[model samples]
Target chain A: MARLSPEVTALDTMPNSAATPGPTTLGEPTIDWDLSIRPVRELNQFLHDLAHNARPEMPHVRILHPNGRHNLAVGLQVPANIEILGHAGYFIAGMNQAAHITVDGNVGWSVAENMMSGIVRVKGCASECAGASAHGGLLVIEGDASSRCGISLKGGQIVVGGSVGHLSAFMAQAGTMVVCGDAGAALGDSLYEAVIYVRGSIHSLGADAREEPMQTDDLKTVADLLQRAAISADPQTFRRVASARQLYHWHAEAQY
Target chain B: MCGIVGLLVKKPELRRELGAWVSPMLDCMGSRGPDSAGLAVFAEAPSTDLLRYSLYDILAQDVWPTVLERWNANVDAAATLAAHGQQATLFSTTPSALGKDWLSNYFPHLHCFSVGHVIDLYKDIGHPRELIKKYRFAELAGTHAVGHTRMATESAVSPAHAHPFTSGEDFCLVHNGSLSNPHSIRRKLERRGIRFETDNDTEAACRFLEWRMSEGDSLEAAIHRGFAELDGFYTLLIGTATELVLVRDAFACKPAVAAETDDYVAISSEFQSLAHLPGIQQARVFEPAPEQIYRWHV
Candidate 1:
């Protein structure tokens, strides 16, 4: 954790040492935007203006004093590295594209909803509907997530390091959800092509959901996802969940 | 939405600063619930025979003298009283039930918000700023405290509807989230001869737990039964004289995070509320699991 001195101001340049170490950060400059003195709308306005501005390179921005306020960085398109210091509220990093955003604290409801691309990481737990109807990107939660984690997920990959509440991955169409910890009731209800991997107990499975044997390729995929999400777990210990395909085509034999 | 916060000091030296630390924790959740706010603080018990009851909505000063006169006439022991704005705290050597009976039988309009040896409650129908201005929360000192800011979801915004609802002696509960089947549960409790003060679902839940505890069940047992019977989303912070218990519903629609250190155990609706506490950076912070009761004793 990076500790900023109280006297440090926005004009005082601080290196982004708190972000997760990655290979891409070779020589890029990291900018710090402290939200304690400034309003939340400033960050949103900066991100919005960044889309039209012709900058030579993508900026790495660090945010402070998240204080559980809603809509911190809602619609960002630039491929910037953004890190929030404390808890944030709803719709954080929503509709993100080609950016890497990390929250150091818990997030409120509907985090990363309808995200198109990029990586959104939460170091703490998230409230309901974590990644609803997302197309692409990898959303990682290091802590528990509440109900409807991946509701109506389209093609995004979500990895939860801790347990998830009920109705997770409900009506998920595409992509995969990996839970290193337990999952609540109705793990995947009305699921489609998306796959779910759980290492811990599942209270109950939802409609048209069943456990499938993990193949070699599935293990590799789980391992890859865990590595990308920066979670440590035994890939072989996970059980795969997918659609039973029983409700794919209507049949008179499948009577009510 | 509603915000609930609880702080239980484990170290004796930090007891005096409990209220100062908790005031900011409650204020941080101002956006979650802007309608009304309340808090219950538990300090050292004054005496074994002395029972303290905090009352609200007393319009005139004569009401207290009349009640004290009537109470002294009925009971052999005399009572002492103090007033702060519309609220009053009365201390009597009589049994708690006797004091309650006197209030109910004589002063039907006055609301006894809390009745216990160590618990003193302060609440009002206003924002957190107004609550702070009316009741200097930082001036209070105690061992443990529970605070709530309610965002009128189930009932109207009023002082009586404010949270930290009390049913048992030295016990109060603040809740975040509405119950799906509170009316049905209220009916069952009403049949058991339990009286209710508000139409709030959290009060219904509090009364139900009180009834369960009265029926020879422990607090943990009563909470487990609540998990099985209660419907809808909730994250409840229940405070006793010496304990603070945190319980979340099965679905956990409401947010609750708990942080514990060697000096204190704190719970809030969000981590930001606990961020400013002393030594909170190194405290163990995590969200309580759904349907699991976590208790910390003083």
Candidate 2:
């Protein structure tokens, strides 16, 4: 409630309360929300209130024509199955607890930022800072992610099917990032315990981050993540990137 | 934050729809920026000896007709003008520099923001929707258009300070990010006798890149040079007589998504603006990469 509402203007976010439940097509409870006329806040508000409702079996929520709007499906605490039909905007599926969200198209900045649990998937590309500072969750981007992706990561797992731009995973504390494509400049700068697995070429590595020989557990991690994301990639081609731990303490006297 | 949008139509039939499509695109981005808005349209150039100048005086109330009458009497008797809101498009056989000097010397309040064979400019301080309505942007016909919705983070909110800053003929640029070293760059350009119209930071970048093109570098080469000279976070969308070019800084934190169909190429800071475009469902949608220049010709 403290952040922007995105509903006050009533410009593109007009309410379409005339949305009706389906005629039982999928065997599970199904509901449709058309974002071309329906407000994004109403969808998020419904998702927020789903935890308090009495129905233990959640309906499948499908969003159509998101139009790159900001703050969609935010702050979900229920275990509902949500699917976005088209491109959504920034901070979509942010702060999730136990829901499974799927985006069939590209997303804007900060997709699934600060998630505590559950899964978030992007079938297309993503903008900057994907899965940033999440306590726990499984996030997937099937295409290239822009710069500063996964910066300051807490304990999230990010799997990218395409390359990541420059300065990805900067100052990451913990978690794992498996990039199926090449990494752009300054990958894993000032890194800590978080590990990175890149299958393609690396532009460069940041301060104190170096490539280590892959262990058996790293292959298992990559394989498990790619399987969960439903992407096909060879685990043997990936290289491990982690912290060198040199900047943990500073030397009092050093040459400039 | 600022919102920048660009559209270039490939098919001749889509030219008339430029204003109608771009107006809603700029209006929807009001969430990111709201203080002011501006638009620069590049129509098919007239095969005449005349040069076109887009002039503005936001403080004046219905002064375009009077300005046109005086220009005909004092500057050029053959000068023809089309007055719209507080803005006007003047067509004359004189050199553009002569037209600019006349505006500066005689009518100091009237600022010529654009001078070209194919470009027409309009900008104001208000909601983007109001600017769109006042200027009758929906009826405009153009080969391409570039627009900006600004929050006035660095300079004053005025018609001059609004975005879509123009430089050498038929060239305009709209920026979505800030520059850390605009003053230093301004000083460097000023040393070369580059006269600036405003102290806004984006003007420095526009003038710098346009200067590079003036020095015989191609647009792509100038942008590569800009990568070395300009220091900041920026996603610049430049429109020329025949092309619309887009580039993001090294980090590319400022977002921009583009959707290209057979009929048109549409770009916005975010995708919401382009959601309603024709055949957008079948368009090849993608995000512009870092430091890469993407150019689509009309």
Candidate 2 lDDT, B83-200, residue by residue in tens: 7767889998778877788888877888898999899999888989899889988999999999999988888998899999988788899999999999999999999998899999
What TM-score does candidate 1 reach? 0.90
Q: Write the per-residue lDDT of candidate 2 for residues A142-252, one digit (tens) a residue.
A: 999988788888999999999998889999999999999999899999999899999999999988789999999999999999999899999999999999888788877
Give the winner by DockQ: 2
All candidates: CA RMSD in angstroms? 4.3, 4.4
Interface RMSD (Cα, Å) for model 2: 0.8
- For each candidate, the alpha-carbon lDDT, in order, equals 0.85, 0.87
RMSD of 1: 4.3
Q: Candidate 1: misplaced stretches above 4 Å?
A: A1-28, A124-127, A143-146, A200-203, A215-220, A230-237, A248-256, B58-62, B73-77
lDDT of 1 by residue, A149-176 (tens): 9999999999999998899999999999
Count clashing residue pairs per candidate: 0, 0
Once model 1 is optimally superposed onto the true structure by TM-score, how far is the C-alpha of residue A162 displaced, in angstroms?
4.1
Candidate 1 local lDDT, residue B86: 78
